[model samples]
Target chain A: MTRRLPDPRPQVEIVAGRAHVVGQQCAACGLRTTLVVSACPGCRGELAPVRFGPDGTVWGSTVIRVPVAGRTPPYCLAYVDLDGGPRVLVHVKASTEPVAVGTRVRLRGDSGGDLVVELVR
Target chain B: MSHQAAVLGVGTSSFGKQPEVPLAQLAWSAVQEALSDSGVDARGIEAAYVGSVLGPFGSAQRALQGLGIGRIPVITVENACASGTTAFHEACWAVREGRYETVLVLGQEHMSSRITGAIPPDLGDPEGRSGLALPGVYAMAASRYMARYGLTLRQLAQVSVKNHGHALGNSRAQYSGDYTVEEVLASPLIADPLTLLQCCPISDGAAALVVGRAAARRDAVRVRSCALRSGRAWGYRSEHAWGFEIVRETAEAAYAEAGLGASEADLFEVHDSFTIGEILSIEGLGLAAEGEGGRLTESGHTALGGPQPVNPSGGLLSRGHPLGCTGVAQLAEVTWQLRGQAGARQVEGARIGVVETMGGGVAGLDGNACVVAVLERP
Candidate 1:
């Protein structure tokens, strides 16, 4: 018989036909982070699974014009600060123009298992 | 039996794309020069510490072949880009603790043979798996910095122009040109707000240093202090950029140990892996206040002839970055400057110099590691 190991941290999930990023919230400190961790980095408290955003603010972003590790050129990568406390690095859906920092974005779906976000407007 | 350590000799292979040179050959060139410079033969070295990020396993042993150093301990260290300086730091500690009277430190990398484009991020990392490369990471920081401090595109391009101009005098530098801000901006864009010139070129090179007890040489450059620290977990509430706090913390430790302030140093060889990196590094080293690095660069205070000349050897931007070799190369440049041997790029009457190298990137942390060292003429 073969046994499969469980993965506690799931970066993305579809809820009610909308994709949302998953994070952990510390029970003691109430700190939330998208980074996978067993214990709270802030207070070493027990953590519970939590879902964040279909909506967030772009903390920072860049247009990668060079190819890297099989990824094509001219794709935008951004750090999105979700409506909740967690922040995540995700790929922004390529648009006619580059995404601006502080622009509101919403999670569209998953692209190759990586979260994909789009401009809210 | 404890003694203070000093850098008795330094050497480096010319920095550039040299796919023709093998890793061992590249490393041996630097090792031979360093040994000869110190007036010490291969047999005189008591132990060796080699730093290489991407070289084959047992690279140190391979590089030391036919050196006739016997069966002495040949330890290897890999701390990402800071590997070279970390090796130097370890060699100094061994000498200072009296475990070895003299030790050899070498940092080598042959990127052309191994990497073609941008250095790939660790796929194991969540961010790296999300299609984030090194340039993308720095571009994000540049974006945030611009949003917060109103930094202009011209100010960022000036760093590339300044370093490339400084490289004109460095015979061993990989790239050198009298580039205007407009020219720098016009270079192909690798990432938004950062052009190809702003990013360091991948090259092959090696640097070596001989570390011994300070009393061993009458004209030795004393190793005032070497501080190394790993990044701490940074929350969203943090005010500074990702790697800023670690550099600051490490520099503070180095300053306290050296018994000198940032103002006392006449020159600095900082890790300018990217144009934005130079600004972030200077601020982290206390050379400028937070968010003031752009203004400081624009004011030309960190230029070759300014009050505090930085990267007179051209830095990683113009000098070429060969992963593990960069830190050792920076130290070698500092050693040369202190000895007044740095030809045309020399800072007149230079006495004190600082070398800082920060390395690695991981999720949830400011940086992987940082090494800061203070050197002074004795």
Candidate 2:
């Protein structure tokens, strides 16, 4: 007699998205919200599609001491609220230290254009 | 609104790096102990939630199915280290929602694989992809904290020493060896300001609890109020990265829910993912004032036998951070104490306990999935 083994995989599928431009439009008023993506996070509206600009400005920043993926410790993580409609999480390759919030930045997409991000101003 | 929830039973598997046991069996050890303690069998369970940060592939369903508890719906929560408490919050909420009479909250994980260098999913996120591994992440924060607050590495080492002393008596702890503050500082820097001894070893452990709406008996422990909230951005609030100042906001809400102030809580088990965590958490939890946690630890005010005993089970630092099992493990210690069952590590006259679990990556979860529960002696 032969026996079968269960699939060695998880039931959940978690994906990693790269930096890329994604649209965020409003429904009720039929007007575009802020250049940033979140109209209302707690209770979101029926968001529509509107292409964003490739550039952005750094609104805030933080340096994590715990484990991360791409860069090493003392690396920079920033909150870049873009020109079009979404605020993206990104890294400033140039310097991990001494970068202030509100630095002008250009929204740059990763190689695949899936995860949209911004570099230093 | 103070809700009356009691911990009827508490169970925990031996905590360490155990690849020998399957994930399900790890959970099973706690389940069996809890069921027997609560005097409630699997049949009495209306719902179940499992908290696991790393379950080695489909461990939740696999583990639940073996115990006959799979018949009840199982929802697994993964909030990094807070995963287990996140499960606890959900189980308690189910009872609060009146959807389930008896709920089982289990936090279990096996991270022995880290012996070969394991990178968690957060590192896979693009943010982490830029490096910033656990040590790097917290160390970076600690470095900045030192610059701003004039903190020292010795104070951080003392945090580890105090907990190690506490763990010497906790059989369920991941680490129990006693180390001096000097030994902690000499343990080699995994990250600046954080030495090997300063950081918690990745562990494999399981802790389980059986909670119900009934009143706790003399031998049972009651949960006066349970509260869990996610991190939210107040827009330029900057509290997310700053310790305690932000977490304090949530602690206040939990105390208010219990109709008691911070002065009433006797014991605390917080998410001490890093040594700095304990410093900030104590203050954030209102056990100390802002920027005063370091002073409290130096003065031995937060030791196991101190004024407000913190992390008597050695906490995540000495107990081994099995991620999912930590929060429930904290609950296990509290339940044991309130019921007068903590053996050598018990806190005398302990009542109105607090188990604060801050999960997920970052100094504090920046408004992502977060939860906290406050339990009282009722």
Candidate 3:
């Protein structure tokens, strides 16, 4: 019998059945960041974990043709600005539809707990 | 009154593949050239600063060891691509502060052996997990630039055509040609709207500078100011964040230090690693008004011999983006232009010159690091 390997963990924690990306907000300076840090880069304020949008606007995006991290060619990537103030990087699903700036997108959780973005047609 | 620092000499190795030569030897070649150019012997060097990213850890010690420079205070800088100018900034401060009379700054990279399409990202960052890299980030910017300002693909290709044409006169540049805009557009696309010709090729090269106190040499170029800024990625709140804010702030600081404004610059050497990069950087640096960079280029305002020529050295697009070497190379080119030494591609009567170098990118940040400086002919 072959042992099952685990999927890669999500970059940010997600509550069960919730389709939102987690972010951290500085309690003092009100600065928000998608990446987790002990102290705020702005004012050295303490950070508290917060949940951001289930949707966002695609600020900028590209479909990489070269192989990246065992991922096949032609996978889409985007800098998605959440409905809230935070911005995060998301892997868009493979589709013929063009992903341009300002395109609306929704977040979905994969089996690995990673969030993938889908075009909200 | 503030102290002054001057660049006494500058040197650079041929910027292309040099796998047959060791990294230290490549650095020593540039070092020897700098020592000869400055007419200052190795004995005159009081301290050294080394800048590199992927090279060996103690590359400074190894390079100096190969050059037979006896013990002197050496510090290695690894501020991404800004490492070279970062070293130069530290050297200028030392000279101005009276800590060292003369210092050497060297930036070297060996991309021929260890680099390919895009640099791999650390998995610790979520963006890396999402497979976001340099090309993708810049591509996103290109897309936004196109959407926000109505910039066309043809207009962007013109930058490559112009820079490559300028490189024809530069014997040290890795790539040179008289390509047309159509040709640039026809090249294979690396990222959307950015073709092969539109992206800077990776190469192995080295650039060195000798900086000293005021009036150090007969033809030294005065270091008016050097300013650096790191990313406030987490704090920045904008969908259109293309790292321009950092460039703007850094440029403002440098101008304040130099007691001048963008209008005072006769020429510029910007971080044009990609076509859109030049467009965004020039605007951010205040060379052109916001959202007018592409229009300015289209109008031939940024070309050589224009009111204010930019990247007369062909920039990273044609000169090759050898990482650590790029920033210091900008200084060398600007120095030559200011001293009336840059032939063929020189911006005539260039008095005030600006050099901007930026590097490193993380998932949420605009840019990991940036360096900007102003120089005057002396």
Candidate 4:
């Protein structure tokens, strides 16, 4: 007999050339979050997988100048609040200028399977 | 029978980059000092609780090997940065429940020899894998706070200035200097809006406390309350910033347990691993209104001689943060301040002191863990 192993990639999928992150929504309370959990953290209700956003608004951002996690220095990290719901931490395309809070952004793709976002021109 | 817990003695190894000192030796020094201060022999310690984040396995046993206290039950705690105080909290409960009359709580970390740059987030953490470093998290908070509350860069740098200045009188501090806002801002940037001076340095040290029944020592600083809480799931709809609610809720719980308000505390030793951390902590601790911590700090209201001083022992920024060691060190500082033994940097007439330490970096949550403790001079 043969057995199948679960995919190790993040729950992000690309549809119609746009990135969408697979999250969860509470069946009982309608709460959404990117954290994979068996029960809703808020109400202890059942949760179902839900896809969130190709677009979002930058809640906060920072330019990391120190090396970390096998990555070189000078990168941007941001908390983007997806349009449908759920806030996710992702890499923002670094620019000469700092990413401002509340900047309109959209999912560009994923970096090594991790979500990445960019400013919406 | 229930008993009241009190800190019989507290001690700390010098806070700095001591790469030569082994973790066991670092812990031994603090343990020895605490034992001497409390006038308690090694054989008298009925139980031991140790906290360390990056230390080797069985660190508690290894550190206590030479002291002949190995036979007692040794529990090790690892709650990221809150490890020390969490151990202290556990020890307090053990004493309170009559599990042990006297117990030792020790926290030690030797990061200088192992880590060279910014401490990486856990490999298993989604945010850590997404390139979100610790400084980046605090910097993002600073950005959001600045945009929302009109906090200036100068106001943010003032946190570093005040903390560094406070460290001047702290003999155990790792780094101290008379720094200006301009000087702080001029330091090499670690994360946007957060310079090198704004971040705590990589340090190696340990701190220990002796906890006993309140009636055992008449001069002991009473452990009025020690409240520990884990973060809740936070999403975009969350009312406050990432770390705000957890700290607030934990502080509220601690204050309620102690039967007093934040105003009653004369001093505070909060987790200021970054400059922005201090501002957020002050607001969360109810020392200032939301969005008002910057103004309160800029006005010198949180300085050493201020009405309600914060981090009179220089805080993690200057006293140095050894992850697990920080919370224990904060407790020691508060104990000394409450007993009027904190010379030069003493908060005069400090009858009560509050200590808050937060450990974070798990994805999709406010924080990993936070501890809020209230101590009183009796």
Candidate 5:
């Protein structure tokens, strides 16, 4: 609508979590971006980049029958809502079977060095 | 109004998972149409710009080989869904820059290959190396928009229904028939707010566009502007800051260059990779008021005969997305509309048209790259 107005407030802090996600907060509007972002897409606020805090419940998920570039079929992926409230989409770490929506997931790094979510304790 | 980009010719092939037809054969069909449409010989052109999402080894040259279009300098351009549009941009640029008078633009894709099935080991930096897929990225975007805006699943389903109906009239589109909103809602939910119908199908096809400088009558549509840009500053903590917001930002510039506002444009051909994407694109490009795109769809503003007809060829929704051919097809569709060539799906007395094609790996906040162009017949 409005040309991506700048993010008036920018906040990002990398912290410890099962799987890390970038944290975000707006200073001007006090809007909290549930996921780590570079800028406030709504406002032109420059975001402070950081890692995600782990311990999220599955907001939703699906097993991808569509294969990855070099991977096998039935790749597990999901959107996890952190215990702290931010939601992020990610491929759950490797497992033998598919993933379900609402599965409790722990965060961890994947083979490529990106933060990943997995079923955990 | 005579800045000088004429639609010399255009061509397109039926869209689908036609693995039976080799990639070159797919390109050849569109290429031949463009040459014949413009009434020009293949050798009359000095250069070529081919847009493709995924091509197997010198694919454009291979496709042209069948047409005896060898010995001409050809370059492949890849810009995700905007691949075709990107090709158009380069051809127009060549004309504007006064390098060549006759240039060919093409957009094509062949997703039926192994590329669609496996992740490229060199997809991207560490972020992608860790394994991030497009569906999840868009799914995340859908989730955030729904949660914050209170957009309902029913509203999202309406998008698929509307687009499905639009595609029904497109003889070249892959999706057919009318679907009820309820039926869409009842379809399998691949993502939280997105159903299977909401997403565009993987396709293999190509489209050719012939745009060059030529004197014409007052009715000729000139290439008003083809503004391409990458990166916009959006401040969101949870937003995917990885890719650029090229579509919205570039569309803004393109509108300015065209000496018009988004409202002045009569029709739009945008990249509807996912149905929700259409909503976001309209809002992002200033075509609709923010938080009002979905409502516009519900209100029938994006229908074929509405104030603004979007994706008349069923867009990527009904029209199959062949990477390289998409942009050419979009331009051809727009040209036909401007020339009053679109039959059943034609927007009566249409004059101005705009196209938005954005592609690349899905990131946290926005599309990776994009190209937006504005055209008019005066």
Candidate 6:
């Protein structure tokens, strides 16, 4: 009998085998943010959690050549502008392919509760 | 009449590596110079505000403790790279509100002692945990800006060439040499589209300024306005990268307070921590229209002798970015220019100038903090 481990990130939920990201919208000012907080960042109003799509567009990207801890060199980082939601920073899955602005992307999450983006041609 | 704050004197230590110097010693160097330059005794300073990014928790108290300036109120400011200017802003407020007759503002940083390359964002931040370093973040913005505006890489490299060329006249600059656009393009790449020549070096240095009532110093420069703002949270819509919105709003507020417009300023000293950073800043500050900053640089509109000269003191690109020191250093350069003391690189007959400095990176937010200050010759 294996004990079920609690998810590490509060903003991420595992439904069946798929992962979905969550955020909060202010009850007063309509301000939205990716982090889970009791009060809204804008108006300090009560917030309710809302789920966002696993799809977004690559607003911008960069190829980092410098060595980073626990990460491979030359990995891509992108600002993924989600559909009907706020932007998020995620690691691009492509190792060799170049990423550009406005490239459509599909968000994917790992068991570790980390999000990454896959470029859609 | 509202109490007014005037800049009595300004001082800056040579910016670059100084591994042998302690943080307090670096601060003292600038403080002593400022005291001498202002012809004001240390005993006259009623309070002190110190700014630093990586300095210890009690760094401000430690900086003023051993100096024998008595037990005056001392406070430390930590607002990322904007720490220096933020300290200056607080000092001005103290003088304006009549809480203190005279105040000392100091900024110091020792970047060369520990880390290298672009500074990392806070580990607890979502973006930082995603491994978004400063260079990578700027590169992403640069890529989007270039694509949106049809800017060429050659045009972008020209900014580095121009700033490095400007640095050749200043002895305090970190990296200074006349280089062509090709040389800039050929330099070792840090992030895609950004090369070694385009990034600010890790440096150690300090700067100091004295703010007092206008009647206290007849030769002082006037602090027309100083505006500071933190980033606003993202709403339902996604915004552009690089925090342009905050820059614009802060600049507008500063200009409104000063009763001036962007076109009225004869010179600008901005945070050019990266070549692309300057492009974004100038545009957001209204020095150039959107998508026109690169073109403005290429056309010589932002050159030393141009109509709207910018970063005549080499900026952070070549003058070195000692985080906390960069902001106050900009004001010092402006003060010199306004006083007609900037011998070689001065904007001819500069009477009005503006300084803009920004700092910190939090994901999903426009920016952490942005400061805009306007100054005029008294």
Best model per TM-score: 4
- Please, what is the whole-model Cα lDDT of each candidate in the order they appear? 0.87, 0.68, 0.82, 0.89, 0.69, 0.81
Q: What TM value does model 3 have?
A: 0.94
> Fnat of candidate 2, please?
0.06
Q: Best-fitting candidate, measured by DockQ?
A: 4
For residues B1-378, write the lDDT of model 4, one tens digit per residue: 999999999889998998888888988899999989888888899999888998788877988997777888999999989999899999999999999999999999999877888897665666776778899889989999999999889999999999999999999999999999999999999999899999999999999999998898888999999999999988788878879999999999999999999988899999999999999999999999999999999999999989999999899999999999999999999999988999999999999999999998887788989999999996
RMSD of 4: 2.5
lDDT of 3 by residue, A1-121 (tens): 1124332224544567658766678899787776756798678889998877778898877777655665666767777778866777777876522388899998875534446878888
Better of 3 and 6 by TM-score: 3
Query: Residue B356 lDDT in model 5?
Result: 85
Off by over 4 Å in 1: A1-10
lDDT string, candidate 1, B266-285, tens digits: 99999899999998899999
Worst 10 residues of 2 chain B by lDDT: B233-242
Error of 1 at B229 (Å): 0.9
The superposed Cα distance between candidate 3 and the true structure at residue B295, in angstroms, equals 0.5
Across residues B124-161, which tens digit of lDDT does each residue of candidate 6 receive?
66677667778887788888888899777887898898
lDDT digits (tens) for residues A1-121 of candidate 4 = 1114333224678888888988889999899887757799989999988888989998888888887857877887888899867888878876634589999999887877668888899
Name the better of 4 and 6 by lDDT: 4
Interface RMSD of each: 3.9, 9.5, 4.2, 4.1, 9.7, 4.7
Q: Flag regions of model 2 displaced more than 4 Å.
A: A1-121, B1-3, B113-115, B121-124, B234-246, B362-367
Off by over 4 Å in 6: A1-18, A28-31, A96-98, A111-113, B235-239
Candidates in order, TM-scores: namely 0.96, 0.77, 0.94, 0.97, 0.79, 0.94
Best first by lDDT, ranked: 4, 1, 3, 6, 5, 2
lDDT string, candidate 3, B46-71, tens digits: 99987888877787788899888868
Candidate 5 structure lDDT:
0.69
Ranking by DockQ: 4, 1, 6, 3, 5, 2
Give per-residue CA lDDT, model 2, range B1-378, as digits (tens). 334567778898888888888767888898899989999878888777888876665788787778887677888888776788778877777776677778898888888854444354342243343343555445645654565565677788888998888899887787877788789988865655677787788788888999887554456576666666666433222433434444676788778877887777778888788898787778778887766677778888778777788888888888888878888898988888777778888888887788887754542235344445666553
